[model samples]
Target: MSTRPRRPRPPHPLRDRRSPWWRSAALAGALSVAVTAVSAPPAQAQLDDATRRITEAVSADRLRVHLQAFDEIATDHDGNRAAGTSGYRASVDHMVGALREAGYEPRLQTFRVPYFEVVAPATVATVADDGARTRLPSREVAAVEHSVSGEVTGRLQAVDTDGSPGDSTSGCETGDFEGFAPGSVALVQQGECSSGRKAANAEAAGASAVLVFGSGEWRHDRPARGSLEEPGAVTVPVIGLSYQAGVELLDAEEVSVTAETVSELRETYNVIADTGTGDPANTIVVGAHLDSVPEGAGINDNGSGSAAVLVIAEALADTEVENTVRFAWWGAEEIGLLGSDHYVSDLAGNDPAGLEDTAMYLNFDMMGSPNYGRFVYDGDGSGFGDHDSYDAPVGSGAIEEAFHEYFDSVGLASGETGFDGESDYVAFIEAGIPSGGLYTGDDHTMTGRDARRFDGRAGEPYDPCFHRACDDITNIEFQGLEEMSDAAAAVVLRYATSGDGVDLAPPVTGPGGDGPLMALLGVLAVGTVGLATLLMVRRRRRGPAG
Candidate 1:
């Protein structure tokens, strides 16, 4: 890790509007839904003067200062903010210090993970019955997280893979491992269950090692390695092989593989800060993953999102709110969304009240990717909403609509990204919590249609420097960050000052589509109901930080 400061780089070249853009429709509908049946509505349901001030305060320059702080932390430490590393620690310290300086009480929650690293290259080799040996190309195989360190040589057995590249019940159950012998290497396909479960079955059948490969679509499928579904659950060595490499293994009668990984037990931290005002019974949880991938500083991959959140949090520090606004900077997001997942899991067991009161969980990951797209989560589940789509909770659609309205009010044409549960919002949705947020593309390449829709380079990855040493402050798109930050600020302030949507009954829709549900400013507050809220989280893990 290097601590020397690099040449100063401004986060962005272009500046977006600094003026506030609050849609009256949002104010009317948001509070109409928020106050549903609560008695005594606030004196003004309109966007308050305070709302305008805070949203206007979230300028690109303010955002730049925070990103620069992160860049300095990464530069002084190994050019990254990966969890469990000194850089990540510095990152946490910087964030906490900022919150403390801003007159907010910041808390740190600690957790441990089965940290993993690769000290040497892993290879897959095979042998024939005639004693001849063949070595596969290095690119054909990879080691997944939590894989035990070992070099095992034994008979190679191919599990049921439905004869496809990687589809169907490759290893859905124990029966898939029928006749498996101890010390033998089992080959499984990717599908149905998690990679951990597939490997677990092979290990249960006495297999010495497990080789998991991609499914039907070949290289188009997701990466071979991901954080284990259950990190400590698997005991044998597990490797991900490409389709061709896996087929070659199954074609051979014997295979000798070396899977050696260096792993350590380490503790990481999550930064928790909340507005010390508002209703404890109703909360709006806003979050952004704080750690970067180990490769680079991850300024655009996340620094952009985190920067916006930090500035917005500081801006709202002294604001009044009817509902508690809780902000969280998650750690170890790259490792498996473990930080946010732990918070939710721990909350479920420790303080059900907190989890229950959560009105919504809004995620902002990579919102300023160089080749940005204004993607709101598919809370309405239209794209991936049906039988095969992500199971988003009930109120998610409303959250999505709120973001869309804000974007529309600003003359921005926003598109939808399906809620595949790929970010901190995953746990929220699983608890049947409604969730929505913003995401610019990551390594996914922008397409022709994408260029037309977002006006970015179609052939390049959303963020060209994604997960690389180049994702420093120089990588951010100032305009993207500016607009997204404003939207973030607006939504936060709106929800913070409104009645709890969960505590109050659902607002009755007006006769027309998207019409106001209540009288114009200063309407009657609705009655109260049993309070409950929304949440979500999703990730395979392994990012500079998730």
Candidate 2:
């Protein structure tokens, strides 16, 4: 990855915030729940100052920079910011600029990903039974860049590749895929295997061509003529098929599919900026990905997350937080967790010495959406009182506790969910860094049950228009956006100013990760049994009988 100099863009036209608004009965209900929790007790006095600073950190003007950048990159952006694209480089430049304006300087971290484009005349099921061919559209049927290539005309072999591990060989572990031999087209299922590995295995078995089915939905979904850059190299044209189509080819003899990769050396950049505030060692990182998909402006997919972080950074810029804060706008998150992966891998692999001082990683992904659910991945599950609805991560104790405090204080009927490999948080989690953050639900369908569970609209997708062009500014719910913003702001504030939340001293290095339990330990030691002695002493002193 390369770093880009910040490029200034003209200001975006302002939008009106006081426009007339209408609220639905459902939203009214949700808002009632949101407001109900406001009477909760305040955070400990030790945290008041920090919370005030963080609350003030995320400002409306700061949010504007994010909205502008999101609009520019998603709508007016040159193209998809895949790992090695120029559009990606421009996005990075913008990130670096925003971070500098906010007050923390981040270093450039880079790593490589196989960038596969297109090349060759692609044919899908062109020669099937009785030479009856059903050709598909060019764009719909293409190969992933990392797969082996070859030409063969023989009986098409079908394998049930369901439940197999991604990049694992167990599904193909048995025979030499007997029915799917060299000179034949092998058809495999999608789940349990990665596109890259499935293609690689077929190519290795001397199979001339490969067609992977869409796990279950469609038999022969499409010929997998896209990027097939698997671990080990085997050059074979691979195709993806719908589950139905792959089944149709089971008995077909002498079938052929051809695909190729258009290799290009493109450039993608990571942006770096500095608050020039505190030391780099005791750092606070707040981040969101900056790229959009090729289809529509990914406003909600990430614009929500990106926008919130931007606002938070601006709010905290001139303020003083104990530890320095760094904000990163990662690129190429959709394809894989590319940007953050590159940054961390390069650090741990190349310079392990620098890892000790890095304190915390905070992520903000989908914060703004018409229908959103506020969730925190319990980093350590320590403070998860009897509320069984939430699940926390093993080490996210400090962060998770802070979020719960915010939620409890706000009286939001919040729940915790397990961590899935769907965002940039993975990079930090894998590195054992204490990480935690908030995310509104995505892509998952929202049902009436969800509505009753979470105080929001029922019978719709959490983000009805997730990952599509329809994910524009108008798609989000203002109430949900405000709640998320406030909650995150609170956590950021608490972490920045005081307490172990921002304390970079590794738990082990200081008093052991046992600080939170100390007060409880003291209570159990004397509070429970000391009351009787105190009462007796008071009665004796008062000479009650006399």
- What C-alpha lDDT values do all the predictions have? 0.72, 0.56
**After superposing candidate 1, which stretches have Cα over 4 Å from the reference?**
1-48, 76-79, 126-134, 152-236, 246-256, 294-296, 378-398, 443-461, 466-470, 499-512, 516-546
Q: Total clashing residue pairs per candidate?
A: 34, 53
Report the C-alpha displacement of residue 236, candidate 2, in angstroms: 2.9
Candidate 2 structure quality by residue, lDDT tens digits, 202-272:
76777677776554433244543334543235566666655555555566666767666545434454444
- How close is each model in CA RMSD to the real structure? 11.4, 12.7
Would you estimate the TM-scores of all the predictions?
A: 0.73, 0.69
Could you tell me which 10 consecutive residues in candidate 1 have the lowest summed lDDT?
533-542
> How does residue 519 of candidate 1 score in lDDT?
27
Model 2 alpha-carbon drift over 4 Å, by segment? 1-57, 78-81, 100-107, 117-122, 125-198, 201-208, 213-232, 250-267, 272-274, 382-395, 408-413, 447-454, 499-546
